[model samples]
Target: MTSIFDADGKQVPCTVIEAGPCVVTQVKTLEKDGYTAVQLAYDEKKEKKTTAALAGHFKKAGTTPKRRLVEFRYFEEDKQQGETLTVELFNEGDFIDVVGTSKGKGFQGVVKRHNFSGVGGQTHGQHNRLRAPGSLGASSFPSRVFKGMRMAGRTGGDRVKIQNLRVVKVYPEQNVLVVSGSVPGAKGSYVIIEK
Candidate 1:
C-alpha cells in the first residue's frame, strides 16, 4: 500500500494480490444472518491435511480442496451451490487491502528493531557500549519503567494489513497476483486481497 507521501502528493507502489478461487462457503444477510458478507475458502489441501468436517464442507462446495478460509465483510451476492470466486472480480488500478503475515525477526535490540538511536559514537574512551539501550526505569521519581515500551523482543511474523493497495495485475490462470508493494512472509505465503 502507499505510505506517507512528500509535499508533492504522490502514492507509492502498493502490493497486488490475486485473491481467490475463493469458494462461497456461506453468506450472511442483515435480516437472517444479521450481517452482509460472504465467506470464502481458499488454498488446496491434501486429504490427509484436512479433517473430515472441513472435507465435507469443501465437497459440498464442489471445490477441489482448501487449507485456509476467510470471510469478507459487507459484500453481498447470490451465489449458487459449488460456485467459486476468482481474481477476475478485480481489475487494474483497483484499490484493495492485502493481508499477510510479516516475516519473523526473532529477538533484536531497540536500535536495530525499533530504530532507536543508541548512545553516541565510539570516541574519547566511550568503551564497548555503543548501541545499548540506556535508562529504561526512571531514577526513583517514577519508581519503575512503564510497561509496553518499545523494547525489542519478537518482531514481525505478525498479521499485517496493508490498505489502499493498487492492483497492478492479475493472473487468474496461474492464481498469481502481483501487487505494487512488498507483501509479508515468503513467496509461497497465502495473502488476502479485499476490495
Candidate 2:
C-alpha cells in the first residue's frame, strides 16, 4: 500500500496492484463446455514445481507454467488462446472490483470479531468478565442454542470482494494499478480484478 497526491494536492491512500500480464490459457465455448468463459493464467511457475497434467495444459496454450489460473465469465471481448492481457485493459478513473482472500485472524473472541462491547464497566462481581460474551441465550426457554449465533470463532481468511474502488493510476509499462483505499489480502497475494 502507498499514498499518492491527487490533483487537488490531497494525499490519498491507495493500494498498488499488479494488474496483469495474464495469458489466455483457454477459451470455453457454450457448445463445447456448456458455458462461456475465458481462463487466464498469471505469475510464472517453475517447470519442476508444476504437475505433469498442468504442464500439458500449458503446453497446449504455448505458454510456460503459471502459478495462478482464474476463469472470468461473461467476458465481452473475444480473446483467443495464448493471447496476452496487460494493464492497459483498465484506465485511470475507472471503477473495478477486486476479489481475494482476506488475511486470517484465527480464533478471535466476540469483542474483536463481532464488535461486542464486553460486559461494560467492571462492577458488581464482574471479575475478569471484561471481554466475555455476556448473555448467550435463555437457559430453559429454548433449551438449546440457536443457529448462527455471533460468538467467539474463527475469523478472516475468507473470500472477500471489494467493489467500486476507483482506479487512481495505471502503469501500463510495469503492469501495475494504483487504486484508492485499501484492498483485502496480504502482500503478494493474487487478486482477481473485474471491470
RMSD for each of the candidates: 4.9, 1.1
Each prediction's total of clashing residue pairs, residues at least 3 apart in sequence or on different chains, is: 7, 0
Residue pairs with colliding backbones in model 1 are 14-180, 14-181, 15-179, 15-180, 15-181, 16-179, 16-180
User: In candidate 2, which residue pairs clash?
Assistant: none
Task: Provide the lowest-lDDT 10-residue window in model 2.
Answer: 117-126
* Model 1 lDDT per residue over 62-85, tens place: 776688888788674576656788
TM-score of each model, in listed order: 0.81, 0.96
Instruction: State each model's CA lDDT, in order.
Output: 0.75, 0.95
lDDT of 2 by residue, 1-195 (tens): 999999999999999999789999999999999999999999989999999999999999999999999999999799999999999999899999999999999999999999999988887887998999998887997888899999999999999999999999999999999999988999999899999
At residue 91, candidate 1 shows an lDDT of: 78
